[model samples]
Every structure is written in C-alpha cells, then in structure tokens.
Target: MRSTLPTFNEVWQRQCRSSILSDEKQFFSKNTFLVACSGGMDSMLLLCLLHCLFPQRVRAMYVNHQLQPDNEVWATFVQNFCEWHNIPYLIKKVQVAKGNLEAQARHARFNAFQQTICSEEILVLAHHQQDQAETFLLRLFSGAGVNGLKAMQKIAVKENIKIWRPLLDVPREKIEQWIKQDSIPYVTDQTNFDEHYDRAWARHTLWNVIKPRFPKMQTAITRTALLMQDADEILYEVLQQDFKCCGNENSLDIQALNDLTPARRRQLLSWWLKTEYRPSLDTVDRLQNEVMYARTDAQAQFFVKPFWYVRYQGKIYRLTEQQKKPKQYEIEIFDCQNIVLNQKYGLNKDLLKESLMLYPRIGGERVHLHGRVGTWPLKKAIQEAQIFPWQRDQIQILKKEDVILGIITPQGFWLAQSDYCVPNGWLPKLDGVSV
Candidate 1:
C-alpha cells in the first residue's frame, strides 16, 4: 500500500533538490517549508512533490485571488486533495482590487502569503524553465536591462519571506511528462491560451518560433543570467558600501554617485529604478533626465508617482507625497494579526501594543505633537505632518479604552500610530527625520 504522501515526497526529492529536504543534505537537518499551490497542474504537482519528499516539513497553501469563475471550485479541489492525504492546508482569500489585473492580483496574493511566512518557513514556487525562458523573452521584448533579461532567480526574498523556484532548471514539458507518467489529475486553465495577455501570447505562440531558432538558448540564458547575477552581486556590494541602504526607500548619495563612471552611475540608477521601485521605463527615462543628469539640488523634486521617490540634497528619498497632503479618519476596531505596513521614511512595527482598532478616513481625529503647541484634528495635523491624502486610513489607530495612536498611513509607516510622540532628543534618519 503505497501512501499518496510518500509518492509526492519522492517526486519532490527527485525533481527539486531542496536542501531543506532530508536526503539531499546528508549532514545538516532539513528546514521546513510551505508550498504555494494554485490547484493548477504545475502547483498541484508541486504540492504532491513536497508531500512526498518532506511531509512533516511541508504545508500546502492556496491563495484564492477571487479572479477566476472557478476560484471557489479550485479551492475546494485543493482542499479535498489536502484532506484526502491528511496534509495540512491553509486557504487564504484575497480581495484582489480590479485594475492592473495581473499586478494587483499578484501583489495581494504575495502579501497574504508573506503574512503567513515566519522565520522558520520557506516558500517554494513551481516555476519551471519554460517560465524562466518566457520571463527572459518578455523582459527582452519590454526592453529590460541586464537584470530583467536575467529574469527569474532561483531564490529571492520579500520582507521576511524566502521564495524558491527549484523547478527553474526543469522544463515545463518535463513536469507535464511526470504528471502523466504518475497518472496525476490536474486542472487546465483555459485562459492560458488567450492572447490578450502578453505572457500568454508569448507562451502559446512565440515560444515555438524562438526556441527552435536558438536551439541552445536555454543554456545561454542560464549562463548569461549567472554572469549577470554575479556582476549584479558585485554592483550590489558597491551599492551597499557606497549607498549604505536598500529597499524601495533609495537614498543615493549623489556625491558618491558622481565618483563612479557614467556607465556605472547609470547602472546603479537603473538598478534602483527596476529592482527597488519597479517603475515604468518611461518613469525611469524621465528620472534620468530630470534628476540624475544634472547637479543634485536640495529642492528639485522628481515626483515618482505611486512610489514616491524624490531626488533632493544629493540624496534619493522614497517617501510618498501623501506625507505632505492632508488626511481624515474615524475610529473603529477589529481583531487582527500582527502586521507592519510601511509608511514614509520609516517602517512601523504593527505589534499588538494593546489591542486591535480600526478606523476609516474621516473628518475628525486629533494628532498631538510633543514639541509643537496643542493637538489638532488628524486631517489638520497631517497637513502639519505632511501626510499624503492617498495614504490616509492606511494607518489603523489602535484604540483600547479611550486612547488613540496615530493612524496607519498607506506607505507602511505608523505615522504617530500612537500619537506623534517623538521621544526627546531622538533624531531619526532618512528624509523625514524629526530630530
């Protein structure tokens, strides 16, 4: 009687050499992991593989983006799959905002998964070599630089999450072959054939044409991406030494930047734009002309939209203009998990300081500044605090009893989440330092 979990585990061990896998690393212990399963063939196989290899260390996680007509059906299918095998499964429903269809859905999905990941858990994605090649071609067509052309990396991080794409080395054809050989039941997403989406079009049409012409293109991609990643590592090392910072909040020291060759400077700038901000190429081009080309000025601001990045005083600052605009709020509360939403300049730790409180953006709320005169309404005070309008209500002012902390601004900062209480003589760093 061969158990289903064991069969899945074998596939995982054979296909993906996750060191957190038992036999793969002889000396060290295997680290635990969570697999992101979409109920699609690729991820279903992924779930089975993980269960087969390291059942105790692996958990299947399904995120319902609520986009597909079969969303609930798919979730139910996954639930039944997990239940039959006695595997632990988590189903997370994310309210995907309608616009930027792909991007918004992806962000929401990742955010929910990120919320689930802890220091002990790593996330595995079933992105195969076809995905790798498709990503590369897509980046090339989009006129992406070295990083984009390099495409998907084997492993990456977001916040506290570790994302691993072990199947990057394996072709999608191989996965399909295995599924068939194993007699695995899988769902086919009909939308994959639609040409409206660029990636879908690329996968269905362009891949056949380009793959044959190049023949050994996958090897070239692998080698070139490796070289690029290596070069990028060195560039990052320099950035770490010279810029001394990371994240979307890029504060580049122009004086230091000027020391590098024009090409190096451009590369660094491009890196910041693509990797850190994920801005449009038009935005990047505009930035090069507006901010990077001329002498760095203190007040000359390049209003990088969505992600508020400004070049000022020979430094790059990633803060939303929402900080400068006014905000309105009303109080409410809900029992919630601990989470940190980033705000302008700094990150606010969303600990359960006292209790959970929710508040909608409304007209009346007071912000009490320490060194300033008296308190003012949250709206008026944000004008003083320079909080942006779009970012209002992002900050949940937790109220237990009669106390009100500052609200959670959209940028992830707790902007006075507990009243604009800047401790005495504590000078903060970055652009908005209230020393």
Candidate 2:
C-alpha cells in the first residue's frame, strides 16, 4: 500500500518548522518576531502556531482601523486570547485616510506597523496561497507584466523593516483544516464576506467560478506566479546592469540609453521607475513613446504618481521640490584688486573703484559681453552658455545701474573686459601668485 499523505496539522507543523530554519531564521532567532494579529482566522492561526513553537520569541499586535462597528469587539477578543495564552500583545489605533478604502486601511495598518516595529524586529503576516492567487489574477486582469504578477513575496524589506509571510506557500483550506483540527477559535471579519472590497469580490465571486472549472486553479495560478517570479529575478539582473551603465542617483543618461533598442529602452525605463515608484503598465508605455523618443529640442515631462520626470540636455532627471530664489548682491570692484574674474579679468588699482550690482534674470535684460557686437538677451546668453532653466535664478549678472556689465557663474565668469580692463603691472592673485 502507498504511504498515506500527512495530515493538515502535521504538514503545517512541518512547513512552519521548515520556514523557521530558512536563511532568515537567523533574523528571527536574533530579533523579536512581531505578529500582525487582526483577530481573524488566518492571523489567529498563525499567532497560535508561533506561540506554540517559540513562545518567548514572539509578540502580537492588533491594529484597529475603526472601519466597522465590531472593531472594538475584535480588539477585545484578541486581547483576551493573548491574555489567556500569556502572550504579549499590543492594540494600536489608527485613523485611516479618506480615499480608496482598501488602500487607505492597508496604508494606515502598515504605517502603524512601521511606527511600532523597530529595525531589529521582524513582522510576521499570514498571507497564504489563495491570497497570492487572487493577487496574481487581479494583476493579470489589470494588464500587469511579470513583476506585478509575481505578487506578494514571502519575504520583503520595507522602510528598513523585514516582513516575513510564513504561510505564503500554504493553502487557505489547509490553514482552515489545521485550525479545525487543533480546535482553535478565531473571529470572522464581516467585511470579508460583504464583497465590497476587490479582494473579497475576487475570492467570493471570481474564485468560486474559476475553482470548480479547474479544481487545482489556486495551486496552478500560484505555480505560474512562481515562474513569473523567477523571470522577474532574471529581469532584475538585467536591470542592475542597465542601471549601472545608464543611471545615476537622480538622472539617466539618454546617449548611453539610445544605444539600446526600443524594447530595451522600455525595460530600462520600467526598471528605473521601479527603483522609486510603481508605475502602471500604461504609464510605462507612455513614458517610452512620448518622453524617450521626443525631439532633442522638445521639452517632455510626465508624472508617475508623486514624482515628476523631466527630459533636458540629453538626460532624464527626476524633479525635486527645491525652491530657487532670485538674489542680488553688490560687489565693489576696487575691493577685488587682487581677484581674478574668469581667469582673465584681473582687478587692478587702475580699474576705477566702482560698485557693481549683481542680479538674476529681470526681463528684457541684455548683455554685450566678451567682445560681442550686438546685445543679446541675458536669458539667451545663459541658454547658449548651456545653463539649465532651474539654475537661471542663481546666475549672477554683473551690472552698473540698469546697464549690463558681465555675468558671474560657478563654472566661469563672462565679464565685459574691454570696458573694465586692468591697468599694466597690476596682477590679481589669491596667495600672492600670478596666473
């Protein structure tokens, strides 16, 4: 006779033990395990298993989103359960944001977790194979690519905190059966059955229809997700190479990127955005078509959620919220008798003692500098000199009253030397040295 398959309880215990010994076991062994308990079946079951395995190493946290009438009751139940088991527990209250009920609640809960859990602690959650399958299907229907389809990871690092989902590979039915076999009691959140949430709708309606047609649908979908996850790992290796070649802290090199095919360009763009933001597939496609291929002279910009991408000077740069203020300064040329301007104009005693007003762009300002015949717009001069638009406010224009004398910049000085030439035998030096 063939050997009997292990019971759900035995299999669960084995999986838990196996997971506890994985590479991250060192992390759990060294750090306190913070279990996110919601008083629900999945979380309570996980809490019980962890308490049984390593009682001293774990503590439980219940986040009260206050979305439902029974939130307090759920909190009471969690507290009572923990107290009865002599397990450490905490109840945290959070005010969920007003938009996108599901997303806001999740954000608030995670925010609580982040605020409460320190870097040395690892957070344990109870997401299972069914949840992963639902996420995979939802992402697939929403036109997600390989990365998004990979769905929830068994282990993730966020905000310097390690999150370990121990039951990510375990099926929900198995968890339920294990709970039943152990006589463990857990509260049910009414919202899970209400079906207003996307996840609930997927589980109750879509999953019901799909599972009967294909009895092993959840396992099959999860396997596909694992395959996609493998593909995602390969893509990540390519991403690192591309990023190394064409990326910087805040900008990407367009010239090095142009050597890549359009598909490769898209891949790099997607990878680049993923480092900071999670852009939709449509958004990534638009970025590749509208921004990457635009004319050199064309100014292209796009917003991916909270960040702004700007294309200029053969590079793509992420816009930061830095305020540039136009400033004016007065410098006495006589005081600069030993100062060299632009490594060419050396202030000498023969140069008249005069005060020069330095101002940033004030419309209609024109400069006739560096032996230029006709006057050109100060803005045009700055542009021709390859100054970025955002740096315009910081450009210092050397002036006498309303007349333009020259321009002083960090790179070099562009002064009208003919009008203010240094006399013979007077040298400008920083340390009594002539250049």
Candidate 3:
C-alpha cells in the first residue's frame, strides 16, 4: 500500500506546530517572521500557515520577478488576499535581466528580501523536500562535490539574515493537499510547467522518469543530503585545524601550506576564500596543481571576486586594487595659533604659514626619522614598520614650496631627510588615506 498524503492541517499539526510552539522555542520565540509570498502555491501555503500560527507577528512580501505575462495579475491577487486577511504586505518589483533567467530572478528576489528584512526578523521561504532533492540531483549530475550536494538547509543565514524553511521536510503533495483543502487562492506561473527551464526540465523529464522506477527516491536523496551536510561539517572542523597550523587570519604561509597534502591545501584555501570569493572546483584544482608548487620566484595571481589572490614572498596575500589618490593636495591654513589639525598632521605654526603640500607615495622618496642616522627609503621604512601592502601607497609626504618638510606613515610623523629641527608644542597629524 502506498503511503497516504496527509491533509494540510494534519501535516502542519504533525510536522510544524509542536516544534514551532515548543516551550524552548528555538525559532519562533522572539524574531519577527517575514513570509516571502510569490502568489504561488508553495509561498501562499507558507503565508497562510504562518499567519494562522502567529498572525500578529507575521508580515508578508510579494516579490514580482516580472518574468511571466500574468505576473501583475498574480501580484494583485496577493495584494487582495492580504487586504482581506488584514495582514501587512509589501510588494517589490524587480527587473529580470537576460542570461540565466532563473538565477538572475533568484538573485534579485533575495536581494529584495535582504534589503527589506529587519535585523530582528526571520525571512521565511517555502522550499520543500522535493526541491532539495532536485537541487541535490542537479548538482550531482553537474559534478558538484560535497558542498553542493549538501543542498539547502531548513535554517540558513543569508546576507546576515536568518532564513527559515518550515516546510523543508514537507513534500509537494502535502502542499498541494493543503492548498486544495483550504481553498487557498494561488496563481500558477506557466513558465514553471514549460519544461524549457532547467529546473522545470528536471521536474518534468528527470523526476518523472525516476519517480516510477524508484518510489522512495525523494526520501533516499534527502537522507543522502543530510549525510553530506554532516560530512561537510566535519570537513569544516578539519579545515579549521589546518588553518591554525598553516595560516593566519588574513594570509596563508606558503611554506607551512606546502607541508599539508594537496587535498588539504585545496580544502583550506577553498574554506578561506568561501567568504569573500567563491572559487570554483576547477580553480581550487588549479591552485593546488599549478600555483602551490610553482617556483618561489614565480609571481602568480588570480582574480578572486573583489580581490586578487597573489603569490609573493613566502606567503599568499589577498590584494585589492587601491584607487589612486591625488599626487598633491594644498591645505589652506587660517590663523596659525588656532589651526585645527588636532587629530591630523602636527606641524609648527611657521610651517603652517608657508605653502604646505601633501604628496602621496610616488616611489623613490626618502625620509629621516628623529634621532635616525642617514636618509631611509620610504618604501623600506614602511616595510620595516610592517604595514600591509595595500597601505603603502597611502603614506603622505608633507612639503613646503621647494623643500620637503615631513612625511606621515600610519605609524607616526617623521621629519624630512635634511631637516631635523625640533619645535615645541607643534605636531602635524596625518589622516593617512582618504583615497
């Protein structure tokens, strides 16, 4: 005998109610719940159930991707439904850009959610177990490893916002049963059934063929995903230990990193770059094979999103391109007695009275610190001071009309190479980098 699909109320009572209303209240005790209503069956069912559970604490938003011809009609339906139920509603419209239409829509929709969700609120999505299985299979077919195979989580934090999927374990049949039982109004997007889209193709072609041969495929896939998630957690712990041994918080020591196995190196590098840059599996493979074992003198760099992964010296550094600052800036001084560079560059009244120009590091500049022996190259001084590579260009030189007065690194102010005169109660403060 086939397992009977439970009704909406029965499924909710069996699956969600007890946990959501538990005394410990892990999820729903304090945070506001914002339902991502798309006027579709999955989201609408979620909205109805959340409203029933916590009416006063619930809010809903309709994200109109504007991809379908009847999207506005669906939006209107959602608006009217919210009005009837006296529930708070927000409608966000996004432009669906070309190329990877599904991905772009998802990105735009989640951006809207992140922008609209409050700090203390939880964004509720309506992804079900079947969706998770589809994602897992899709990733598996695409040669995805453990991270991608782990698929969606019931509870996740995206863009610093907590997202809850109360119906993650629930099946599509259960949601359909609930919609029918409650007579809930929902608009079906024709695109979902078109089968041209990848997900639709997966549903129509892949799932339809497999569902008959293997009756319990969804459950099996879901269980495998859970196992993968556990494995992923263990891998993260191992990576953390490796990171402690081979890397600092911001950089990886190449010598220490080379000591680890190639697999371990790839794992550590992937985990480190996951936050700011999503390096693909191929990229990780290349880094392991090519970049890691390359000659010590060989300089290699790869673009990792907003920053570049640069191999230099004996370590790997994440270097971002710094915007150029003006070569020189002239500061107009008022009364010398009450000049206001209190937190800035400290200069004497006489120097302030003269034409003072600030110049950024353009290379080959020399500076002499107080009590120091001959002139030192500015770059060497910065290196000795242990400033980051990105901060070197930010050092400023304070000069008068034809002579160098002083220079400012983040460490402190130093006099010009030729001038060593000390002035009482006169200190020029440098703001360092505005560029």
Score each candidate by Cα lDDT.
0.64, 0.75, 0.74
Q: Which lDDT tens digits does candidate 1 get at residues 361-431?
A: 55676765333466667677666556433455444554445655444554333334343232331112222
In the range 147-226, model 2's lDDT, one tens digit per residue, is 88888888888778799988888899888888888778789987887788889999999988888899998999989988
Per-residue C-alpha lDDT of model 3 across residues 64-86, encoded as one tens digit per residue: 88777788898899898888787
Estimate the lDDT of model 2.
0.75
**Top TM-score prediction, candidate number:** 3
Which pairs clash (backbone N, Cα, C closer than 3 Å) in model 2? none
Range of the 10 consecutive residues with the lowest summed lDDT in candidate 1: 425-434
* Pick by lDDT: 1 or 3, better one: 3
Off by over 4 Å in 3: 1-12, 19-24, 275-277, 288-291, 323-348, 356-367, 375-382, 387-404, 408-412, 417-420, 425-435
Per-model TM values vs. the true structure: 0.66, 0.79, 0.83
State model 1's lDDT: 0.64
Q: Per-prediction count of colliding residue pairs?
A: 31, 0, 10
